[model samples]
Target chain A: MIEIEHVSKNFGKKIVLKDVNATVRAGEIFAIIGPSGSGKSTLLRMINLLETPDGGHITLDGTDIRAGPGLTLDIRRKMAMVFQKPAAFDENVYDNIAIGLRMRHVPETEIKKKISDVLEVIGLSGYEKQRAKTLSGGEMQRVALARAMATDPAVLLMDEPTANLDPVATGAIEELVLRINREFGQTVVISTHDMLQGQRLAHRIGVLMNGIFSQVGTPREVFALPKNKDVARFVGIENIFSGRIARISGGVAEIESDGTVINAVTPLPAGTSVCACIKPEDITLHLVDGSQTSARNVLDGRVARMTAFGSVTRLVVECGIPFSVLITWKSAEEMGIAEGKPVKISFKASAVHVVEDTEVRRP
Target chain B: MGYIIDGLREAFHLIVSLDPDVMEITALSLVVSLTATCVATAIALPVGTAVKFTDFPGKKVLINLIQTLYSLPTVIVGLLVFLLITRHGSLGFTGLLFTPQAMILAQTILILPIMTGLTISALSGVDETIRDTIVSLGATRLQFLTSIVREARFAIFAAVAVGFGRAISEVGAAILVGGNIAHRTRVLTTAISLNTSQWEIGTSIALGILLLAIALVVNTGVSLFQQR
Candidate 1:
């Protein structure tokens, strides 16, 4: 396991990372999700000692990376990092992939065997003699990945490795990430600006923003329920309506807005201004039939817009306030959902989450 | 037009016949310049790469000054060497003045900046990404630098070609230090100048053709490498 504690970094009087902590278990894929300039890359670089942390220490399996007893190479050799932009050696492809193994003084026969194997794994089998400098951007990136795995590092760190790639290339890299993890059992730490990608690939995800981690959990928890307004909005929570707490009874709080009433399971007191959060996926659409169930909250609205997000479909409903619902394509097809269609959407009062209006959590 | 045609005819004949005087001059030119190029390369590459990559106060100005030396006049270099090698000058007891040794000294000094300056420029063209890749590959410092040298191979090749071109074609410096002595210190450039002064157009034109051919061959080789 790799444990990072209270790490901080600064660049020219600017706080780039503050009090950051992460725990990555062995053989698991961990992702740090953040926007641009959110210090995610800095944290990864510090783990490899490429950038020294200003305040805290990171340890891998009980050895501190900053400890003076061992050469950083001994630590670095166990961890491989693939950069955002691929940098290949000026030699041929064969020699490029052989570099890490050669550094360890691996036997020539073993180096050749390993390089040939990785070249095939990266889908560049026939390119052994081709010049690395002549490869295309995606091909060179694959070679960079191959070189990183040549020595079979115990941990792999990636910083926006697919940020510059086309979708086809991105798909291949995504598959490669899972394959390498399942096959080699290496711990992987990746940072990306794409939340959906982080959700898809990682076992656990951390949301990094403004030099602090606001939330870290399984993708389902972080996506289904955000702890605060900033995270809720940043994570693509579609409906965050301003409301005032009305009254509290039996672990449920009534929230009154401009033209609608809602209830949430919160401990906020009456007369306090708060924001009510709801995920689009949590808003389920019904046929507006007379039949009803135990769901506490329900409303009728005309579909304002319909759009497809890959396999999932999203629709905006013109209730008193606009509410968005994300549903499976099959469900949308069966319900005949389209723009301007009147439909009923409902969610339990427990689905609503409330947070104080004046709170800003920063680490 | 007739005069030019006849000169060309005689130049071709002299080249074909392999005239001993022309051969000696051409051989000496290659030997002296190639020696200087080799010696200059041994010093310039390490020095240039070090001075370029090392961070120190006034580094940019230092690089600018070294590049400025690329324009230093060859005659000024000859004058410096002439003073040092001339009789009654400092360390003049060895009598290298008016010898091939003096000519070689002048040429080495003349091309040092060309080699060093162009080397610095070539290495600076290496993307910052290359350094990060090598260092992250678990390479020792020596391995990192050696790999970079390989990456900058073409640029260094061009620098060597340019340096050798300058050395082989320099007339003023070679004449000043070697005194254009016949069959001994005479090179292609100095011999052409001497023969032209004596109204020996055939010999002068033939030597000029040979020099032009050598430059063409060197440049073509470098071009092939670049294209490849």
Candidate 2:
């Protein structure tokens, strides 16, 4: 387990990280999601002492690394980091994978066996002698992974590991990460801006903003109960409406937005202005009377735009509030949804998430 | 124009014939320069690695000091060493004033800064990722530097070659300190200078051409090593 205390850092006059605290448990994939320049990478670097914190300490396995004696190579052996850009040494593939083991004084025979094993694990068995500079971007990242895993580190810190790869390559890397965690039981703390990737990979996710972790929970918990508007927006909540509460009802609040009353799952005091969020997938598109669906909130509108998003077609229903719904291509065809056609959009009240009232809006 | 062609022909003739005087001077130059370059490299490599790897107060000043030494007048260094090794100077009892060892010592001083500065720049210019990866893999500080130096072997070799080239072509320091004694302390450059002063243009020009050719060969070898 790794525990981060109140770690704060300042670069000259600019504060990179304010009092940030978090804990990463063993054998779980923890993901940190944030926008650019939000100190996510800096926070990850603190775990390995690549970047030291100015204010507080970090502990691994209950030992305070920052306060203890100079962290020898022994301490480094326990944790490894994979950078956003794969930083492989200018050597052949075998040498790159063998370097960490060689540093640990692993014998020549063992080094050879470990390099072969790691290369095989990364699915590059026969590429031992290939120069790292000649490999493609994806292959190079795999080499970086192999090098880190060759030492069998207890913890792996990753910074936007797949942000540079294409979708197929990203998917492959994500699968590899999942396999590594499950097979080896190595704790992983990965930072990324791709919310969808976070949802797919993270057992638990933390949302960081302004050098502060606003919320931390499982993927479902975060999406269902985002602590604030920023997290809701960050988690791909498409239908975020800002309005003042018109009335408080039985376990629900009627919010007035753009001269229309909207119902949210959470109760709020009357006259209080707040933000309400709904996932694009949570909204249902149906070609029927507004009263047919079991959904509580129904709006009638014309189909302002339709786009064929891969694996799902996105329909923008220009109604009281322009609501976007993602449905499969088959469903879009079954409903005969197209641009300029009138349709009814409905969403369950339970799916409507209410967030904090802040001038910093997110959609 | 006639002198130039005649000089070129005589230079080729002396090289082909391996004249005894020419051979002795060439051999002395090779021995002294080789010793100086090896000794200087032995000292400079560690200093360069330290300068690049460690950060301390006055580090930049020390680097600048080395650069300053690189441009120091050879005659001034020659005079300084000459005074130190002279009979009347400090530690002058050993009588090293007019020996080939004195010439080597002077040339080593002249080229130490070249080796150190070039090595420092070469090692420092490598990819930072290489260092990060080595550290991430649990390498000790010393192991990390060793790995870096291994990867930077080509550049370090080039640095040594540069130092050797500078040491071999040096005339002022060797002549002043070694007294340019014949059949013993006279290296290629010293012999060229002495023979030219005596108006022995053919021999002087021949030795100068040979020295230039040797310098080119050394530089070519350095570049080839770098390519690998």
Candidate 3:
């Protein structure tokens, strides 16, 4: 397990991370998701002691790495990191992977076997003699991954491994990540800005925002129950509205935004300004006036727009406050949902998670 | 004007027939310059690698200073060596003023800065990712540097060649500290300077040809290595 305690870092007056803490257990795939420049890379670097923290300590399996022992190489070799860029050495695939094993003094036959095995795992077998620089970006990143896993470290840290890859390549890498985690049972911590990728790959997820982990839990917990408005925004909550609480009773509050009143379950005092977050997938749209369901909030409005979004269609309905709903195109055609058509959008009161804006606003 | 062609003809004659006098001077020059370059590289490589891999206050200023010294005038270096080994000067007890040792010392000093500056540039030009990947791959500090040396081997070999070229072609320092003594401390550069001053045009041109041949060999090797 890796323990990060009160880790803080800064460059000049710009704070990259502040008082961040998290524990990554062994054999679990952990994903850290955040916006760009949100200290995701910095936190991964701190774990390997590549960048020392400004304030706190990180312990690996019980050893305080920052202490004065100087077995830093042994500690570093215990884990491996793959950078966003394809950082292969100026050599062929065989030599590039062999270097890490050689550093550990692995025997020659074992090193050759390990290189071939890692290449097979990365699906680039028989490319031993190819110069790594001549390969394409996706291929080179795979070679870099093979090199990282060649030594079989106890923990694997990858920073945005599939940031700009095509979908086919992204799917390949995600499958590889799952295989490594399941087969080797080596702890994995991957940093990504894609929430869907985080949800798909991570056993546990950490929402890193403004140098702080605002929430850490399973993917379902983070996606459905974000702790703050900022975390919700980062985790793809498109329907966020701000309003003052108008009525509060029995653990529910009615908030008014853009002349639309919304009822959310929260214990906040009435008249306090708060933001309501609702997932786009949570709001269901129907073409009829059938509001006879268990839902507590329903609005009647004209369909503002509908567009095909990959596997799902994104439909927006305007009822004073526009709400975005994601449904399959099959349902869109069956219900005859289209632009300028009157439709009804409904979601449960429990689906509306409320959060106060604690971050300072820029003028 | 006719003497230019005649000098070239005589140079070929001396080189082809391997005249004993010219051959001895050629052999001594090769030995001295080769020793000085090899020794300087042994000293400079580590210094350059240290500067590349470690952080220190005023490191940039120091690097710039070393670069400026790369074009330092050889006569000033000769004068410094002269003062150091003169009879009235500091280390005159061993009588190394006008010997092959003094010439080697001067040539070593002349090429040290070149070797160090070019080495730093070569190693620094290596991809920054190499360091990060090596360390993350579990390399100790020493192992990390060994990996860098192997990665930057081509550029480093070029730097050594450039240093050797500079050392072998230098005349000012060699002349002042070696006194151009025949069959003793005379090298190609110093002997060429002497023959040129005395209007021994044929002999000087012959020595110049030899010096150019040595430099060509170094540069040819450099270009071929860089192509890899």
Candidate 4:
């Protein structure tokens, strides 16, 4: 387990991270997800001790890694880092994977056995004599992974390991990461800008924004109940309306935004200013009245725009305000959905996530 | 024109026949220069690696200074070694003046700067991420240094070759410090100088051809080694 306590870093006058804190549990994948330039790489580097924190200390298990003047080599040996760029020594694949073991003074025969095993694990068998420098980017990255795994580290730190790879290559590397974690029970801390990847791989995710973790939870919690508007937007929530609660009745609140009242289930009191958030997939579209759908909030609107993304088509419907709706391409085609087509959109009252609007308007 | 043609013909004949005097001078030149280059590489590589990894107050200026010495004049080095190893000088007790050892010492000093500077550049050419990766792999300090040096091996090899080229081709240092003593300290360059001055143009041309051939062989050897 690794614990980051109030860690901060700055380069010159630029504050890259500030008072960042998160704990990575043992034998579980912890992902740090953020937009570019949000200090995700810096945070991972700090955990690997490649970059020292400016204001905080990190601990491995219970020992403060930076406590003593010269930290023991055993502590560092327990962890290995895979960089954003694929790096290999100017040598053959066998030597590249054997380097870490040789550094630990493993015997030649044992080193050979470890190299073969790691190569098999990374699915690069029969590549021992290949020149690592001549391999493809994805192959070289796999070799880098093999190199790290040969040491049998307790913690594997990966910083956007597949960012430079193509989609097919990215999937292969992601699968390898998952397999290694599950099979070896190595604690994995990976950082990525792709939120979907975080959702797919991490047991828990930390949403880093503005140099700090804004939200930390499971994939379901983070995607469904984001702590603020920034996290909701980052997590791909497209429908958010700023409003003030007008009244509450029977554990539900009616919020008014631009003369459009939306009913949602919330414990916040009446007359509170808030923003109502809804996931695009949660809204159901109907060609006729959606009153039969048993949903609390129903809005009649015309499709303002339509955009197709692979198998799913997104429709931006303008009711009182614009609402983004995601529906299957087949459903959209069956309904003949197009721009300027009138549609009724309905969602359950419980689907609307409400949070206090803390946005400061700049004139 | 006829005399020049005759000299060329005789030079080719001497080379083909492998004249003992020419062969002996050629062998001595190889022995002296190769020895000096090996010794210089032994000293310069570690010094250059040290200068590269250590950060000091005047590191940039120090690197610039080493680079500037890459073009240091051979006569200056020859003169400096002469002053130190002459009859009454500081190192005179060792009696190294005007010997093959003095010539080797002069050539080593002549090429040390260039080799050291080139070695630093070679190490610099390695990617910055490689350094981080090595450290993250739990390498000890010694292991880290050796690994980085091994990564930059080809470039360092080129540095050593350049040092050998400079050492072998230098004339002023060989003549000044070695005195060009025949059958003793006379090498290809100094022998060529002596034969040219005495109007033995054929012998000088033969020695010059042999010198160029040696350089070509060494360069080819280094390149082939790098290719593997």
Top lDDT hit: 4
Error of 1 at A76 (Å): 2.1
> Lowest summed-lDDT stretch of 10 residues in model 3 chain A?
A354-363
Clashes of each: 0, 0, 0, 0
Ranking by lDDT: 4, 3, 1, 2
> Which portions of model 3 show Cα errors greater than 4 Å?
A164-169, A248-253, A263-272, A281-318, A325-351, A356-363, B1-23, B53-61, B197-206
- First chain TM-score in every candidate? 0.87, 0.91, 0.92, 0.96
Q: Each candidate's iRMS in angstroms?
A: 1.4, 1.3, 1.0, 0.8
TM-score of 4: 0.93
C-alpha TM-scores of all predictions: 0.90, 0.89, 0.87, 0.93
lDDT of 4 by residue, B1-228 (tens): 987888899899999999999999999999999999999999999999999999889999989998999998999999999999999999999999889999999999999999999999999999887898998898888999999999999999999999999999999999888999999999999999999999998999999999999999999999998988
Question: Model 4 off-target regions past 4 Å?
Answer: A258-260, A287-293, A340-343, B1-7
Q: Write the per-residue lDDT of candidate 4 for residues A1-363, one digit (tens) a residue.
A: 898999999999999999898899999999999999999999988777778889998899889887774774677788988888987889999999999889999999999998889999989999999989999889999999998898988899999998999998889899999999999998899999999999989999999999899999999999999988899999999998888899999899999988888899988999888889998889999996443778999889999999987789989999989999999999988888889999999999999999887883435
Model 4: fraction of native contacts: 0.76
Error of 1 at A104 (Å): 2.4
Question: Candidate 1: misplaced stretches above 4 Å?
Answer: A256-260, A267-273, A284-295, A299-320, A325-345, A355-363
lDDT for each residue of candidate 1 in A138-172, tens digit (9 for 90 to 100) = 88888988999887888899988899888888888
- Model 2: per-residue lDDT, tens digit, A1-363? 888888888888989788877888999999999888888888887777777788887888988876654754556789888878866676789998888888778899999988888888889999998888788878888898888888888998888989888888788778889999999887899999998888999999988877778888999988788988888878878788888788888878888878767788775678777888888888888785534887888888889988888899988888777888898998888778789988888888888888758683446
lDDT, residue B198, candidate 1: 86
Q: Give the CA lDDT, 0 to 100, for residue A310 in model 3.
A: 85
